[model samples]
Target: MDFSEKPVLTGDRTVLRPFTAEDADTMWEIVNDPEVVRFTFEPSTELTLDGLRSWYGVRTADPDRLDLAVTDRATGELVGEVVLYEWDPAARGCTFRTLVGPRGRGRGLGSEATRLIVGHAFERVGLHRVQLEVYADNARARRVYEKAGFMVEGVRREAALRGGAWVDGVLMAVLDHEWEARARTDATQVTGEPRLYTP
Candidate 1:
């Protein structure tokens, strides 16, 4: 969805909505977290509040991507974010990524948030495929993606460098029809946390 009309997606545990300037503070804390940095970005990456503010400030106005803040519905607090970017219009595909901070981990909020946004991507955004890459060592993140219906397609050997060691990046994707099939099954079964997260 575009900035002007982005939808607020709600699930049993989390809510996904367009990012706000106020979210930058929490996001800064989340992004700088040791676990977050190790898994999602490089340790050498430097971030600043002003830069975060400036970046998030304009996210809603951007026409090409969908970036949403993931919030815990119980406390109405910002937990993390989920994004769909690198869109290929002709292919009807896009890349997905998500991160959960220390405050929101271990409660299955990330999984629920992923299901919500990926659902919106296929049903509302008219995307045919949603894909992502996760480091093989990040089992928690990969489990969340798998529970949300993404299947591992292959691995990119030594796709990322972490702590001076190369890490494999696992590629995963879910197609529209696969999501629809999962939806039908989900409707028939009682849905709950597949397992506790250690995030």
Candidate 2:
């Protein structure tokens, strides 16, 4: 599985494309959203625009990880990001994570983005497994992951402290065979097939 070639994945509701320097401001706003920060990042963490610009500017140059911007298909607005990092070449697996800002919440954009990138990981990149850790209290995100074919494997007890309370981190993963089976089933059921890296 190679992360060197970042592709644009197209789904029904969203598009996943490699990040550019221009995306830094929008990403900063999304990451700073209270709801987004509460679930995905430390509440007290501070991020500067210059830092974000510098970071995003080189996303495509990083060969070890894939970081794609999640954009609304209809309006072409940046919503969030879907990332696959901490690559294990021998295991052919990586960690997945995503965050949607308020503008894209409750619209199934995040779910579609998740499916698109995960599909690319297994189908095009030849990855064996995709795993993620979701805070147990975030049932909504868990549901999204489940819908995308990730299954709960275990839990890290008290993995994070949020708002003065310890939150458990639920581990989830989807294997390549499992994803392929689900894709074949979806195709038989007439569900939308994911399209990636369209020319």
Predicted structure 2: lDDT: 0.90
User: For residues 1-199, could you state the per-residue lDDT of candidate 2 as single tens digits?
Assistant: 5799999888888989999999999999898888888899876677899999999999999888999999999999999999999989999999999999999999999989999889888888889999999999998899999999999999999988899999999999999999988877777566455532221
lDDT of 1 by residue, 3-83 (tens): 245779988899888888888999999998889988988666788999999999888886678899999999999989999
lDDT on C-alpha atoms for all candidate structures: 0.87, 0.90
Clashing pairs in 1: none
Identify the candidate with maximal TM-score: 2
lDDT of 2 at 48: 95
The TM-scores of all predictions, comma-separated, are: 0.92, 0.93
On a 0 to 100 scale, what is the lDDT of residue 168 in model 2? 98
